[model samples]
Target: MDKIEFLTEKAAQIRRDLLKMIVNAGTGHTAGSLSNTDIMTVLFYEVMDIKVDDPDWDDRDRFILSKGHSVESYYTILADKGYFDKEELNTFCQYKSRLIGHPNNKVPGVEMNTGALGHGLAIAAGMAKAAKMSKKNYKVYTLMGDGELAEGSVWEAALAASHFKLDNLVGIIDRNNLQITDNTEKVMGLEPLAEKWKSFGWEIIEVDGHNYQELINAFTKSSEIKGRPTLILANTIKGKGVSFMENKAEWHHGLPSEEELAQALEELSSKGEVI
Candidate 1:
């Protein structure tokens, strides 16, 4: 595959992985994982400095899925990247399975176990601070759901990152507009969201979450942000790739039926071009 085609194919595979895992589990978070599919694909395949062959590469880039419901995508992408075996995904959400609904620190390549909202950014901040203390060059990147911003702790962490001048921390907000219940704006507005981050002393970038080029651009620019943390407001659909599920809140934790699964596979196999 060409470089661009390679990334696209891998992202499609992650989408398929998500669909298969969720439909098989009979219950899992599909929409949020699907929403950030391309973002994960780009991070694992291109953007991040990770060594799958060496899972504990000390200087590797650190990623925290603060929106832990989206662990489905993280597990799939990590497994696909060989951070761990693909077979482990088959045991997801099973009784005593390590692959729970949220990210667990026990899992390889998983930096922390997180399900509760508002926890990821603080953890990322701490890690970045640690790296700074050790004078390690690693960067910490974290993603939070737009709806997850309602948590007060997130702002607290945001304030600390700026106060500490932790430029190594880069945060991303998945602005999918919808959460499990309803639209984010209707539930709790994040209008002037960018400005809010700016006031907190963060350098902000807005981009289309589904665009691999945009993702790379945003991350590349992250290294240049100085004096504090950075945030990327990634505009995304709730369910990004599949035709039926896109922007549908029902799919937040909803499983795709057997037929719907088949349709989703077909749609993703089309690679966002056409049937």
Candidate 2:
């Protein structure tokens, strides 16, 4: 019942919620959602200074899911945190449910609507700049997929974030390596990723994304940095908690069959309960 163990259990439950929501809805980005679950868990549950009861608090921290296809993880965490009713999760991806395939501003805790990829960092940069202008103490964080880095817009935003010295901005790359089409290297090479961010004037910190302690340490260190944005290269596994789906590109966007859902739930149950 310590911090690490608690976060671990919360991650497992979120993954379970994601799998069920996707399977029931008959659609979702399975691998990316699962891969980003731990990072989202730590952010919403521990790292970000958020108030579930008052999501629009003027000084509350802002988070953008730039790799918006991973909305399942974000939504699951929001619901669990009381940003909205958990039952609303069942309406995901339905004809008119607010919880669609990607993050939507209509959702209580969502900062902005995103799904286009490569745009989140830029938006986050603007938010960070606005915070600085208003002299707000809140931070702006955005999570992007490794594949999304291929877009020139991402680099453009990176340059802007550095030039402005937005130390309150944090960018996290979900370095799971597997995108929808293939491995990131095969689709679009982004090797020496840390060096690339460093060159962009970011304080780069690489860590095992699934490890709560490592994530907490990285986020904590990010806050102490000055005069530069921080980029966390979160090395993670695609379809992280599910054995058959792990590291598989096909699971990037797919629906799990009944048997698959059962197996995934059983695997999550073995990890321990969310206390």
Candidate 3:
């Protein structure tokens, strides 16, 4: 198989793991996880400088999952990256498990324990600044939820990153439009979101979050740009793939029923194409 085919299958595997794990765990942010599936896949598969051997390698780039509740996808990707046993995925939300519902640093590959709304950019800014001061080539990638960006800390962190000219930082917004309670437009309109980030000195890119090739291109384009942080506003459906869940706010934290789980599995296994 070609590299693209390989990556595509790997992405499907990640999503497959995500659905099964969420079904077994009985609780998780399924919609968010599904929405960011391709983004997480491309990052671990093709883009980042990371390895299972030493997740904390000083020269390696970093990934921070700011939307931490959507960790099933991220954890599956990490396991695929060889950070830990794929079997550990079964421990999610179970007693004495290293794989919690959120990304924890105790896990070999996670950079930070991040469930809070808007703090990742700040932490990423610090890492980027540190890399600059130390003259390192490492880059930092942070992913956030559009709903979460309503927090004031996001702006503060954005200001600080721009002030320091941390061009090595790449921030991605999973703009799924739906948060836990309501659509972002109803909760708080970040309509001018891209312009806002740009005003804060970030180079911005907008793309269909579910498209693997577009996501890869966006990530690649991010690496080539310099002198400013790159912020990608990835427009995505709240719950992707499964018909009943897509764009439904209730699925934000809903656990699929046994029947629904079976249904999702059947749908995903059908080799359906999504544009």
Candidate 4:
């Protein structure tokens, strides 16, 4: 298989793993996790400069999932990368398991505990600034949910990143539109989203979140940019791989029933073929 086909199959596998994790655990943020799988796959497998065996290496690139509820997807990628044993995934969300409902620093590849929506950008900005202070070349990437944009803290961090000229910081907003309660616009309008980020002094790039080429190009371009942080508005479907759940807000935190899981697995497996 070619590189693109490989990434696509990898993404499909990640989605399959995500469903299994959520089903086994009996709960998880489904829509967001599935929607963000493609982006996370590209980052972990192709973009980020990470060492699985040496996860805490000083110069390694940092990734913070601001939308921490989507961590099932993140955990799947980490395990696939050998950051931890794949068997560990079976213990996800079980009693006393390190893989809880959100990202925690205790996890090998997790940088911080996040699930409070808007705080990730701030934490990522701090890490970027620390890299600059220590003269490190590592970049800091953070992914936020579009609904999380309603929080005042995200904007505050955006302003700080620009003011400090942290070009090494990249903020990606998963513009899946759907949130836990409903569509983001209905919950809190964020239209003119690109313009809003631009106004905050961020360099904006919009792309189809599921497309490997677009995502890789956007992330590569972020590094070439100078003086300001880049905010990538990744337009995506909420429950991307499953037909029934796509764009439906009801799947935000819903668990798939046994039949639904079987159907979902079939759909994903069929699409794993090389293009």
Q: TM-score: which candidate is best?
A: 2
TM of each candidate vs. truth: 0.97, 0.99, 0.96, 0.98
Error of 3 at 22 (Å): 1.5
lDDT of 2 by residue, 1-275 (tens): 78988988989999998899998899898999999999998998899998888989999999999999999999988999898999999999999899989999999999999999899999999999999999999999999999999999999999999999999999999999988899999989999899999999999999999989999999999999999999999999999999999999999997899999999999998986865
In model 1, how large is the Cα lDDT of residue 250? 91
Residue 48 of model 3, lDDT score: 89
Tens digits of lDDT, candidate 3, 77-148: 888778889898888899999898898999998989999878888899999999999999998999999888
Which candidate achieves the best lDDT against the true structure?
A: 2
- Winner by TM-score between candidate 4 and candidate 1: 4
Q: Rate the local accuracy (lDDT) of all candidates.
A: 0.90, 0.94, 0.86, 0.93
lDDT of 4 at 244: 95
Pairs of residues at least 3 apart in sequence or in different chains that clash in candidate 1: none
- Which consecutive 10 residues in model 1 have the weakest lDDT in total? 266-275
Residue pairs in collision within model 3: none
Two-way TM-score contest, 1 vs 3, winner: 1
| Alpha-carbon shift of residue 198 in model 4 (angstroms) | 0.3
lDDT value, candidate 2, whole model: 0.94
Candidate 1 TM-score, true structure as reference = 0.97
